[model samples]
Target: MTLRPLLDPQLIYLEPAVRAYARGREILARFPQARQVEIDSHWRNPELYRAAAAAEDWLKLKRDVLVLGVKKGMTLRPNGRSADFIAPSSSNGCAMACSYCYVPRRKGYANPVSVFVNVDDIVRSLERHAARLGPKTEPNTVDPAAWVYDLGENGDLSVDATISRNVEDLVAAFRAIPNAKASFATKWVNRDLLAYEPQGRTRVRFSLMPAEMAKVVDIRTSPMAERIAAVNDFVAAGYEVHVNFSPVIVHEGWEAEWRRLFQEIDDVLTPAAKAQLKCEVIMLTHNEALHDVNLAWHPKGEDELWRPDLQERKVSEGGMVNLRYKVAWKRRWLDQLLGWMAQTMPYCTVRYAF
Candidate 1:
């Protein structure tokens, strides 16, 4: 998540309403060189990514290609993975260059963030959905207090917060609603979030891995140490802080790296932070298409990610064919990691692991 403040982006394409909205105008002004273009809509357009370009070039140019439009679709989708529901998108893409990211799979060439300006409508939609639930009657693993809504399903809110106010706006909206809470995970550390007093309604999951693994794939994101270091401050900021040991890569020396990572996490946590911390373990889910994209500039990651002998093709709930480590392999890895957590990081709660 690269949220460079003063560096102006080179280009921006704005749709009709987007060119008029306050948020769009704010973003345009930040990038002095950005040019506004008229697009019919952000989601339906195919020429942006399909027509022409190299995947490697996109790694550098995608950050410069910003799309401003309204999110016309307001219906929230059921998501049992982390949150109860996936909130309407605050943003569609990320600025980071993580090679294994699935967001790049569908975008053939261009894959920059499509920042929606109509946040009010998005919030209203969430309001409507939460009203129907009528205060958690049935309890589930997601939460016992209120229904959880994911605000950053498609984009990193930490990076989006720097370029837009939608992240905080959603947090504020969820804070006021008695029946809901906002949740999102981040690979970047946004110091700006410390200003918001969310009343413990916003849960920030800090995604982590060993420094060596991050150095290989999690490109342009905040350093692993910085992410862990922010844990204390984030908890102090009235946010439910959680750890997401995500995209856990399997490689030659992964066990040693994970051992060191767990030890480091144990070393850094105070009783205050550790008492509040919960974790979600996500094993690496790799796609063949993304592997091809990573080979263009970041082949080193694919060397470890694309292991056919250990992996098998499976269609996701979204129906995009993807690869994951075979069942036996995943079980073994998850058991090993969870065992490590039990011994070294006993204070942390493993909410879910896969």
Candidate 2:
């Protein structure tokens, strides 16, 4: 049976500059039934944003709207943990509505998938940046062989694949760049990506959490088991695979749940996948604004995320008022979780953890 379309857009906000691009045109053809509106800028849709922000149905906009625009500034920024650098986005926003997601914090109320149709320019910008870096002379936490560039900082590429060829194009582009590799974290499992032929030049970090906990927070994403089950296949398909224990929500029995999660990963991954496996652990960092937003749409998640008793306020480097597990508790949790990972999946090196 054919699965229904993941995104059946009812309206497309198109930027005139990108209307003629092959990617923009393809997206238009894909959603021929959707109403189209020409907008001056994707970022300046005041009326739509205002209406969506006022409504409780933020997800309704995510489900029914799409945006196509040219990515104006293609600047690469330094990142030391999950990747060496954050590349210009191939797309922004996401269809899967993870309640703790940081993307929607800046995007106001509705955070639908916005495809930057000028993919060739984004790829060219990467090529230029990588050429300037030349070759990696030293190994870093991100990679031992190449400069790892994060391609999906704002969206899930696996979900992005369903909308356009952007992910495939970037994967193919990196296949030839010997000194730079592309990486992205995703909670969704789009097997369509397996055919992209990354040739070890792309790393797919499967974002994971305890199965039951995931249901509470990871809205509309692939089940944890499906992401775990795809590990070996992704490895066999010539892409490096990793796990992201991200936004590691600390609730009652979270330690036990995480231990069980690690054991499952060890049990299911093939020897080859384990050999190449590494992981990054990021404890939950919740924003007050996002907490308010979640309450409106997914209050149940706030039970797992927003904790006044256990969490303390900390301003992020980006200047957002964020809540983090209190220092002593976070330290203890990180150490305990690392210990569990060591005992359960020793072969999976922790590239970074916090």
Error of 2 at 168 (Å): 0.8
lDDT of 2: 0.90
Range of the 10 consecutive residues with the lowest summed lDDT in candidate 2: 51-60
Q: Evaluate residue 49 in candidate 2 and report its C-alpha lDDT on the 0 to 100 scale.
A: 80
Clashes of 2: 0
* lDDT by residue for model 1 (1-354), tens: 986442145667667888678887777787777776678878756666752256656655656677788888887899876899999887877788787888766666366778899899999999999999888988776777789999988889998887878888888987889989999999989999998888899999999999999998898888999999899899988998998998998888898999999988889877789997888999999987677767777788887788998899998887777899999778988899899888998878777888
- TM-score for candidate 2, please give it: 0.97
Give per-residue lDDT, candidate 2, residue 320. Answer: 83
Alpha-carbon runs more than 4 Å astray in model 1:
1-7, 50-52, 316-320
Write model 2 residue lDDT over 1-354, tens digit each, in one string.
986565668999989987779998898998899999999999888867886775466777777888889999999999998899999998888888888998888878568888999999999999999999999999878898799999999988998888889999999999989999999999888999999999999999999899989999998889999999999999999999999998788888988899899989989999999999999999998899889877877899899899999999999787889998999899998998899999999898999899
Q: List per-candidate RMSD values in Å.
A: 2.4, 1.4
TM-score winner: 2
**lDDT: worst 10-residue window of model 1:** 3-12
